[model samples]
Target chain A: MITAEQKPIDEIRNMIAPYKRILALGCGSCVAECAAGGEKETAMLASALRMAAKINGEEVIIEEKTIDRQCVNEFVIPLDDIMEKYDAVLSLGCGAGVQAVADMFPEVPVIPALNTEFMGETKDQGYWVESCIGCGDCMLYYFGGVCPLTRCAKHLLNGPCGGSMDGRCEVDPDVPCAWQLIIDRLSRFGALDRLEKIYPPKDWSKKEGCGPRKIVREDQQK
Target chain B: MNNVSRLKKVLENGEFAVTAECGPPRGADPESVVKKAKLLKNNVDSVNVTDNQTAIVRMSSLAACALIQGMGLDSVLQMVVRDRNRIALQSDILGASALGIRNLLCLSGDHQSFGNQGQAKGVFDLDSIQFVRVAKNMRDEKVILGGDPLSSPPDMFIGATANPFADPIQFRAVRLAKKIEAGADFIQTQCIYNLDRFETWLNMLRERGLTEKTFILGGVTPLKSPGMAKYMNNKVAGIDVPEELIKRMEGVPKDKQRKEGINICVETILRLKEMPGVKGVHIMAIEWEEAVGEIVERSGLLPRPSFD
Candidate 1:
C-alpha cells in the first residue's frame, strides 16, 4: 500500500490561489485506502477550499472528482473532456498518480495535495508503517518476511547493530529492530543457521543503484 | 606488503597503534585539515579522514586523504555508503589507491538527519559489511565490482566500525565477525566510554577468535564538559557514556572539566591497551586535535612503535 497524508490546507490554498476554477482529483486506490486522496477526501477538501476562498473574498470554484486509479491510463481518460474546464487540477493522489494525470493532460497544471510516503501497511487505525523498498530483488524469504532494507535505520544487511535494545532500534525507541524481528522469526522456524552465513554486498545494479528501476517483461507483453 | 599503512604495520608487529581522526572542512579550503594533520603529526601512527561526516556537506574525504598524504602522513580514507553508489565508491577506491592511499575505512555513514543537510538523499546501495567485501575484492582480485579484472589492485587495508554500546550488545561481536569474514583488515569502534561493557564485547570477540582475524582499534573521545557528556549519553546513537563517568566530569570545576575529559580518555586508552584482542586506539577528539598529542603522551601510547 502507498501511504500519504494531506498537505496543510494553507499550502493547498496557495497552490490554487491563481486558479479561479480547479478540479480536486482523488485517487480511489492507495491514497483512498489511506484516507488521503479518496472520493470523500476530495469532496471535503473541495468544500474546505471553497469556504476558505469565499471567506477570503476570493472567487474560486472547486469541483470534486475521483477516478478508480489515477495511475492507470484508462482511469484517467474520463477526465479528458472536462480537463479544460478547470484552470488546474489539485490531485489528491500519490506521486505516480499525479504524474499520470499530468502525462494525460499536458496543458493542465496538476498539483499534489498529499505527500506520497512509502509502500506500507496500515499498522493501526489511522496509522501506517513502511515495509518494503521495492528493491526489485525480493529477499523476504531469507529473513522470514522481515525487511532489513526498509525497516533498519542503517539498512544493514547484517544488523541488530548493537543498537537493538529491547527489540527496538537506536534511531527510535518506538521503532522495532528489524533484525531482531528477523532473528525471532528465523528462530521460530529453526533457521538460525541462515543468519550465520555472511550475506554479500547487495547487488544494487539489480536494485536501485543503476537508476530509476523498471520491470519490462517481454513474455507478458502483447 | 599487502598494505603500506603504518598503522597496519604497527598492529602486525604486535605494537599498540594510535590512529586519529581529521574531519574535512565544510568548504573546499584545506587549511583546517592541514592544521589538524600538523598537530597530530608523529603523535599518531595514521590519520582517519572522514567523508561527509555527520551527513554535513564538506570537502571530499578523498581530497582530504590525499592532502594528508601530502603532509607526509598515512591516511585511512573513510568512505560512507550513504551518498555514493558502487560506481563512485569503486572509482574513488581506485583513485585513492592510485594517489597512494593505503588504508580504507568503510561505513554506512551517519543518518542524514544527524547532519545539516537533512534533505539530502542517502544512497545506502551497500551497507558497511558489503562495502568491506567490495574493497577487499578490489584489492585482492584486482577487479571491479562486476568481476572485471584490473591491471593492478589497490594495496588497501580495509577497516569498518563497531558500536559495542548499541542495543543487543551481545550481537556486536557477531556483527564484527561478519565484517571480518566479509574481508575487513581492521575494525575501529564507535567512541568508548563504558569500559565494563567494552570489556565484555572484547571478551565476546576473543571468545570467537575474531580478535586474531582483524586488527581492532578502540574509539575514544575526550568528554570536554558535563554538557557534552550528557549530550553523548542522551543524544548520540551507538555511543554509551556511563553515568559514573558523567558524574566524574560533573564533579570537577567548570574550567577544569576539560582536563577531566582528557583524564577519562587517557584512562580508556590505558585499559584498552591491556584488554585482549585490542590492537590500538583511534582517538576521535572531535575538533579537539590539539589535545590528541597530550592524550597520547599521558596515555603512554607515545613513541609510536615503527615496523619500518
Candidate 2:
C-alpha cells in the first residue's frame, strides 16, 4: 500500500500560509490503513490547525472532509462544490491523492500534508517497511519473491551490493538486506543455483518514463 | 578538462601505490584540512577527500579536493549517490575535474538516518554501479548521457568501493567484476581485519582474473581500543572483525591499547602487501589523522615515490 508520514506542523503551516480558509482533506484508502490520512486524521489536523491559529492570533479556518479514495476522480468530485468556498486545500493523503485533487480543481492550490514514503506493508502497529518499487516489470518470482528493486538500496540485479552484512543493509543496519532475504528463501527452497543467472540491467523506460503511465483496455472500452 | 593523473600513473607504474583518506570537516573552515593534507603530503601517493563519509554532513569533497590539489597532493574526490541526481552529479564531475581533481570514487553512501540530519531525504537516482558506468562514459566517450555531445569531457581515473565483508560473501568478487564491467579502474575495499575471509575473496577474484582488471586497495583502520574493535564487529556494516583480533587488543594494557592498534594495523598492512591481487592499502585513520604517518612508516611504505 502507498505509505506516507505527516509533514511537521510548522512546514504544513508555511505551505498554507497564503490561504486563510482551507480544506483539511483526507483519503480513506491505503493512507487511512497506514493512519497517515483518514476521517480521524483530517479532524485531528483541523483541530491542531485551529489551535495553532488561535495561539498565533492568525485568522484561519480549516474545514475537514474525507473521501473514499482521493486517487480516483469520482472521490475528488465531491470537493467541487465545497472547494469554491475555500482558498486552498491541504491534502492529508499520499502524493497521488494530492495530484488527483489538483487535477480535478485546477484553480485552487492543493498542498501536501505528508511526504509519500514508499509502497510497503505494515510491519507493526504504526511502523511500516518498503517492499515494492512499482517498477512496472515484476521479477519477484525469480528472486525467491523478494523485490530487490525496492528493498535493496542499490537495486542490484546480479546479487547483493557489497554493503550488506549479517543480513542487514549497509545503508541502515536496522533494515534487513533484501538480497539476503532472497538468498535465504531461495537457499531453503533448494534453488540456490538459480541465483547464478544474472538479470540484465532494468529498463527504467517501463517504470518511470517522462510521463504518467496508462494501461488501455480496448475490449472493455466503448 | 585536463586530468590530474598522479594516482593513475603510480598505479600503472606497478610500484605499490598508497592512498589515505582525509575526511572534510563539518564546518566551512579549510585550515584544518590544509594542515592535515600538508601532514600527509610527503607520506602518501594520493589523498581521498571523502564525500560526507558515514552519512554526516561535511565540507563538499569537490571543494576539499581542489584545496588538497592546491597543497600539491593528488586528490581522489569521493562521490556518493546519496545526495545528488544524475544532472547534478555530472555537473559536479565537470566542476571538480575542471579544478584539476582527477581520481573519482563512486559510492552509494551510508543512509541519511545514520547522520546528524536524519530528517534529510536521500536522492539516490543512480546506484554506485550505474554511477560508475555514467562517469566512465562521460570521461571516455566524450558525451553526456542520452547521447548528447559535450563541449569538453572531464578526464578522470574512475574508482569504486568494495566490501569483502558484506554478506552473501561468495558473490563479493563477482560483484567486483560487475564494477569492473561498469568501468571501475580501481577499487578501495571496506576495512579489513579478518585475513582468512579476505583471502577467500581474493581467491575468487584471482580465479576470474578480476585481479588484473583493476588495482585493489585493501582498506585498513588501526584499532584505538578493544571497544573500537567490538563496535566495528557489532555496529559497523560490511565490516567483520574476528574474535581473536579483538582478544589480542583486549590482552593489552589500557594505556598500551593505542600502541597495539598501530601494531595490528602494521601487521595487516604487511599481510595485505604480501597477498596476491592486493595492490596497496587504504589507511582510514578516521579523525586520528596524526597516526596515519606512523602507521605508514611502520608498515614499510615510507618515503613515498616522487615522479618528476
Candidate 3:
C-alpha cells in the first residue's frame, strides 16, 4: 500500500486560498487505508477549512466528495458533472490520484492535500514501514526474501559494510541492518553460501533514469 | 608485480607492511596534504588519503593522493561509495592511475548524517565490495563493468575495509571472506581496541583459510585524551575502545595522556605483528600525523621496506 500523511492544515489552506469556491475531493483506496484521505478525513478537513475561513473573515464556500479509486477513470466519471461548479479541486489523494483527477477534469485545477510517502506495509497500528522501491528487477530469492536494495541504507549487495553494529544500521540506529537480516535468514536456511558469489552491478536503466516507465500489454491495451 | 604499488610489493615479499592515513584539508589547500605526507615519508609503506572522511567536505582523495605522489610517497587512494556512482568511480580509478596512484581502498564511507552536510544525498550506486570487483576487473580483466574493453586499464592494488567489532560478531569474518573473494588484494580493519574480539574475528578468517588469500592490516589510532577514548567507544559506529584502555588513558596525568596513548598504540601494533594472519598495522593518526613517526619507531617497525 502507498502510505501518506495529510499536509499541514496551514499549507492546505494556503493552496486553496486562491479559489473562493472549492471541492475537497478524496480517494477511497490507498489513502483511505492509511487514514489520510477518505470520506471521514475529507469532512473533517472541510469543517476545519470553514472554521478557519470564518476566523479570517473570508466568505468561502467549500464542498466535500469522495470517490472509489480516484486513479481509475471509471470511478472518476461521477465528479465530471459537479467539477465545473468550483474554481479548483483540492485532491486528498496520492500523486497518481491527483494527476488522474486533473486528467479527468481539464478546466478545474487539481491540488494535492496529502504528501505521498512510499510503497510500504502497515507494520502495526499507526506504524508504516517502506518495503519496496519498485526497482523493476527483483533478487529477493538470493537474499532470503529481504530486499537489500530497498532496505539497506547504502543499498549494499555483497555484504554488510563495517558500519553494522549491534544489528543496527550506522545511518540510523532504529533501522535494522539489511545485511544482518539477510545473513540471519540465510543462515537459518543453511543457504549462507549463496552470498559467496559476488553480485554484479545493478542495471539501473530498468529502474528510472531514462524516462517515465510504462507497461504495454498488447492484449489488454485494446 | 601486478601493479607498481609499494604496499603490494611489501606484502607480497612476506614483509610486515605499515600504512597511515593523511586527511585532506577542509579548504583547497594542497600544502596541508603535502605536510602530512612528508611526515609519513620513509616512515610507512603507503599513505591513504581519505575521501570526504566522515562525510565532511574536504579535498578529494584522488587529488590528495596525487599531492602525496608529488612528495615522493606511494599513495593509497581511498575511494568511498557514498559520494560517487560507478561511472565516476571507474573514471577516477583510471585518473588516479594516470596520476601515479598505485593502491586503492574501496570503502562504504561514513553516513552523511555524521558529517557537516547532513542533508547531502548519499550516492551508493555500488557498494564497497562491488567497487572492489569493478576496480579489479579494470586492472586484471582489462575491462570496465558490462565487459566493455578499456583502452588502458587502471593499475590498482585493490583494498577493502572490515570491522571485527561490529554486531552479529560471528558473521564479521564471513563478510571479510566475501571481500577477499571479490578481489580485494588487501583488507584494512576498523580500529582495534578490543584485542580479544579482533583475535576471534582473525581466527574466523584463519579457519576459513582467508588468512592466506589476502593481506590483513589491523587498524590502530592513538587516543589524544580520555575524552577522545570515550567519544570513540560511545559515538563511532564500528569502533569499540575497551573500557580498560579508557581507564588507562584516564589514569595518566593531563599532560602525559598523549604519551600514554602512543604507548598503548605501540603495544597494539606489537601484538598485531605477532598474530598469525595479521600481516601489517595501519596507523590512522586522524589529523595527528606528527605522532605517526614516533609510534612507528617505538613499535620497532623502523627502516621501512623500500622496493625502489
**Evaluated with DockQ, which candidate comes out highest?**
3
- What tens digits encode model 1's per-residue C-alpha lDDT throughout A1-222? 999999999998888888988999998999999999999999999999999988999887889999999999999998988888898999999999999999999999999999899999988989999999787789998888999999998887877665566687776789998998988898899887778767776876676556777779999988
Give me the iRMSD of candidate 3, please. Answer: 1.2
Per-residue alpha-carbon lDDT of model 1 for B1-308, expressed as tens digits?
A: 23478877888888988999999998978888999999999899999999998789999999999999987798999999999988899989989998989999998888787889888887777888888999999888888877999988888889998888876665677788889999998999989998888888888888999999999899999989989999988877767888898899999999999999999999889988888788899999999999999999999877887656
- Where is model 3 more than 4 Å wrong at Cα? B1-3
DockQ of 1: 0.58
After the best TM-score superposition of candidate 3, give how far the Cα of residue A130 lies from its true spot, in angstroms. Answer: 0.5
Report DockQ per prediction, comma-separated: 0.58, 0.36, 0.74
Candidate 3 lDDT over residue span B126-181, tens digit each: 98888998999999999999999999888899999998988778877777877998
Worst 10 residues of 1 chain A by lDDT: A203-212
DockQ of 2: 0.36
lDDT of 2 by residue, B55-139 (tens): 8889999999999998878989999988987889999999988899889999988877788888987877777887888898899
User: Candidate 2: which stretches are off by over 4 Å?
Assistant: A3-70, A74-118, A122-128, A136-144, A154-159, A171-174, A184-222, B1-4
Give residue A100's error in model 2 in angstroms.
Answer: 4.9
Candidate 3 CAPRI classification by DockQ: medium
Model 3 per-residue lDDT at B173: 75
lDDT of 3 at B118: 94
A-chain TM-score, model 2: 0.94
The true-versus-predicted C-alpha distance at residue B9 of model 2, in Å, is: 2.4
For candidate 2, the docking band is acceptable
